[model samples]
Target: GATPSIDRFDPDLTIRGLLEIWRRNASLKD
Candidate 1:
């Protein structure tokens, strides 16, 4: 996965990375 596991990264970083990926994918679909 593009994002690191929660065990590797802080919770905030993991969440931010996931959200970033989601935004990128959403943009691509537009």
Candidate 2:
């Protein structure tokens, strides 16, 4: 077992965060 933190969160959160970042960057390009 391991303690989860920003450096070790569940994969889902990481992917979602990356998606949100990408979306925000795309919006700024318009």
Q: Who wins the TM-score comparison?
A: 1
Q: List the RMSD of every prediction in angstroms.
A: 3.4, 4.9
lDDT: worst 10-residue window of model 1: 1-10
Candidate 1 local lDDT, residue 7: 76
Please give me the total number of clashing residue pairs in predicted model 2: 0
lDDT of 1: 0.84
What digit string (tens of lDDT, one per residue) describes model 1 on residues 1-30? Answer: 743555787889878988999999999999
Q: After superposition, how far is residue 17 of candidate 2 from its true place, in Å?
A: 0.2
* Candidate 2 worst ten-residue window by lDDT: 1-10
